[model samples]
Target: MFHLKKINKEKSDYYFMSGFTWLMGYLMIKCEQQKYRMMKIQKLYLFNLLCCLSTCTGLRGLISLEHKVYILEPMEEGNTHRLYRGEHLKLTQGTCGHGHNISYPTQMTNTTGHKRDAQSSTKHVELIIVADNREYQKQGKDVEKVKQRLAEIANYVDKFYRSLNIRVALVGLEVWSDGDKCSITQDPFTSLHEFLDWRKLKLLPQRPHDNAQLISGVYFQGTTIGMAPIMSMCTAEQSGGIVMDHSDNPLGAAVTLAHELGHNFGMNHDTPERGCGCRATVDRGGCIMTPSTGYPFPTVFSTCSKKDLAASLEKGVGMCLFNMPEVKVLYGGQKCGNGYVEEGEQCDCGDVEECLNPCCNASTCTLKQEAVCAHGQCCEDCQLKPAGTPCRESSNSCDLPEFCTGADPHCPANVYLHDGNACQGVDGHCYNGICQTHEQQCITLWGQGAKPAPGICFERVNSAGDPYGNCGKDAKGSFAKCEARDAKCGKMQCQGGANRPVIGTNAVSIETNIPLQEGGRILCRGTHVYLGDDMPDPGLVLTGTKCGENMMCINRQCQNISVLGVHDCSAKCSGHGVCNNNMNCHCESLWAPPFCDKAGFGGSMDSGPMRPTDSSGVTVGILVAFLCLLGVGIIVCFKRKTLLSLFFSNKNSTIEKLRKTLRIFFFCKSKKIKPILRPFIFFDIETMIKHDDN
Candidate 1:
């Protein structure tokens, strides 16, 4: 029930890799019943799903990333934005770089950014302000609260940023614990793992860092409690990002800053490749800036996040900055660098392709697409075409003017590069210029009859999965640009046009048992978000939707999910001990060290004095002797089996003789069998009957 858009050869090639690997594995495993007995059918299914999700989403593990983002939260809130009781509000609309309408508080704005201008445009900043009151009840900072809030914020930011064309990132060192247990690490990579407690990867740079300088892996996060209008308007104005919070968690405030600042760099929760399947992957896990209330535990993205980020670089988007040439790079193909490869060659090989000529040399480079040669690689006349402009706009370009100015521009939005006849994303994926309408990736995920992500590129399974909505002012999917640019979504969502899906991790749909009076408490980790009165009956739609305004979080509000990530352990032990959250159970003193480590033998152990190792030397000596005897018997049997079997030709007869021999060897071992082997013993039946009677 899905129509796959014709992905470019390169994209298709990447997508099919796991399939190839799985197929090969399946074939080889089928032949290995004797060689091995692993990877059962159920395991294979999970493995297949994992592979598909990873490939479709382009998810990366810790090592896959090229750029890392760190969200910082200030411990002190004096300098941050402020808000009052009436001024504070729940999320009202969707925010940038996050997802799933399922995200709590769709939209929020506390303060705006520096204004939008050529410079700000280059800076990739879009401003939206939302006042957060999740922590209004708590008089002070709660480490647990901060942890939860950061997860929500990260999830929100993941989807919002992707949609807004802003990049999303993670926490470097997540500070969580009671004041006495505050975590401070000396390790450079903020590994939340180690000696019984280790760390996770695809990490964002985190450590004590300076605020004035914006380093690649470092960012500032904190809280504020001063101005309301300023915070509300900040989301609109991009002067200096601020979250109005008279009494919000410092973590929330800090993450808000991180989320907003990320926008300043034109990052979005979405990757350059806006496929439904890909976005689903981002939302499946929490983003760095998701709201804290939803997921309050720690979790990190797999390394595939690197690929999503790469797509942005190809599309002229970066953390805190926009690269102009990248726009050209998107058009020219994700390869050929960011500018003119052969002055905008007709084609740039997939980043992996290496070509040698005066035009390009890629022997050393293995990751990026191959570059086009400046000389013989391209036609002299065709090379004159500008990478961004449609063929008609460039001299000697075969593309006609209609292609650029027609009802449909040559390269639609979300598609950065046009390879003369078609447009493609930086992921080297293509959208059919015309005819097909569905987003192949989404349909494959939701199947039929399910509502597609809000503002679906097209309707039905055939609908366009176009990452960027229709380009015209009145396009059906117009929400894409407006949301990305931080503009009002014209009467679409608030009025209930099937509320847009704000992308975020761990969306849970609520089904209340009874209709509440007007107000009810929103429970968050034993904390109440509301006072249980005044507000009308409302149930937040978090499941399956992206975090919208929820992205405007301020800290490392984390949550753990098996779907996203699970804890790691070495040898997973402590004899019969189960490992959970990276912690091993030593059971008790009787179980030495890692509780799963058994008394080096394969048996469930219990603490008792009937132990086998009670008398080490004596027990060892006896065991050795017993084993030696057993080994000698086995060797002797192995040597005699064939010779002994030669005389007992019949299969059943041989088995009987072996059994009798075994019994005699043990019971009547003192009597040798040499005398009984003579042929005269043929009086068989009558002799056996007489012997039995006697």
Candidate 2:
């Protein structure tokens, strides 16, 4: 019976071994199949990636080739083209009507009462280009061709603005193939008004962009090819321009578009009197802001344009330009050289030739090994800056500061006071991120000591519907009289400044003496600037100027600031914060965001935390985890005789292994290695288990 039992046990052991072997073989086969399948998927993925990259490269090359061919094509012979002189040219000659002289203050401080150093930062303009029906037809009724032309024009403008530390990113393109969205006419003034109104009412609501420009095929009256409001960038009322496609070559239209865009950026004509330095001579196109544009379209901006941009930025003229545009909305297909970091790209420092960043691999648009970041003010030494590090300081009263998050390389988008919020250090309220007051406008037109005149001046002067005294021009290009309530929203009347309007030589002073019932006469000084028929009169009151205690101007009407509902937005802030342009509560440093009632790091949801994360807790957690693991290993060794014996047999070896493992763990912790690499330490534990099993 004993012999039979022994034989049965042996057979059972043999069957168990066979079953184990079969299971092992099956697992190996399955693993091999999985490995083969994974390899095939990897190969297919690589092939698809290569094809996609090739397609993008081919499309970009085709576009470039088309652009080169079009540029090389000569202008139509015997066209007898009239001299393309823009009306803004009169600015240099002082021959046009009164022009607003935008003088830079001696002190380089912004309206927010802070020093401005905008040169150290870059600004981006999210631009949308629209083609009128006539322009679409001119391009052979090809929507794609019209889009290409407009894109090329935007590219040229972007190139011109690069020197000013500004980027013009084309976000959208609209081809008015069916018809013009707004009125287009030979009268440049009426056309500009209509286009701006349409842009504010229609385009702005549908597509959010920093600015829009209309490229038209219709010829403007006289020598005007383009017109834009000066120093009106990012404003809802006048942050747009109209450009006439006067030349078959897109470069000519690009130059005119750049000039009009410059006007929006607060740049004036590069007249000889400004003593502006131009690297490109007249034969090669003197400067982009030159009043007259002819052959060899100007590609470079003059020193004056750069200065104007800086001054405008300091004064918060282009407040919205401080934020980067959404790369996904960019018009052109993704390219490595476009400077925007798109999906699948770790970093982008511009084209390969222009890339000078040590942390970035420009060709592949990826960060170099060990680099966490390569761009933005919040990234330094290839690492993210600590939270609460100030990235963008408030530029003006309405502007808000942005801080680093310690998790992201880029700074947050800009924020500002809610519209209708009370302006800081000024009597007026915020509108479109600007604090416009009558006194401020007076100072801009006249020199120092300029102040808004008494009520009588505005009441009497704006009543007449003439060029010298009017609310603004009507749709028919005729002056419109201002009602009694809308008087302050019309032509600005001032007192005590330069003897004549300091704006320009063409500006004529209109003095009115209103005799009071008591006796003495009060002198009212008003300016009439003949800025040509196309441009809006700078002598008129600005759109956001305060008309009364709680009133502001809107479309030549005095409206209550409460229409913006700023009070309701502020009430949610719990008095510990202020309402930002996004309508979120920007909490104080000690309070949390979304609402300010919570006690935590400050800043709005749009911005980052106002304080750095605590590191002591992380250190403590790591130490505790290490202790727990050590305790578990000790307990396992005590509970298992095999493991305990193994440790006793090779004490020196075991100690040495433990030392090495600990060293690796400490090193990884010190370097802040990612969690994926932490599993490597467990291999040491596995080796010990294998030794015990053996």
TM-score of each: 0.20, 0.75
The digit string of per-residue lDDT tens for model 2 on 310-415 reads: 8777777887877788988887656564688898889888755467999999768999999999999899999999888888877778878899988888889888
Say what the RMSD of model 2 is. 20.6
Clashes of 2: 5
TM-score of 1: 0.20
| CA lDDT scores, all candidates in order | 0.25, 0.72
Candidate 1: which stretches are off by over 4 Å?
Answer: 1-258, 261-285, 293-359, 363-382, 386-694
Q: How well does candidate 1 score on lDDT at residue 84? A: 21
Q: What is the per-residue lDDT of model 1 for residues 249-356, given as tens digits with 9 covering 90 to 100? A: 233343345543433332233333332223223333344333231212112322233343333232222212321123221111222321123343443321222233
The pairs that clash in candidate 2 are: 89-291, 97-530, 97-531, 98-529, 98-530
State model 1's lDDT: 0.25
Give the lowest summed-lDDT range of ten residues in model 1.
Answer: 208-217
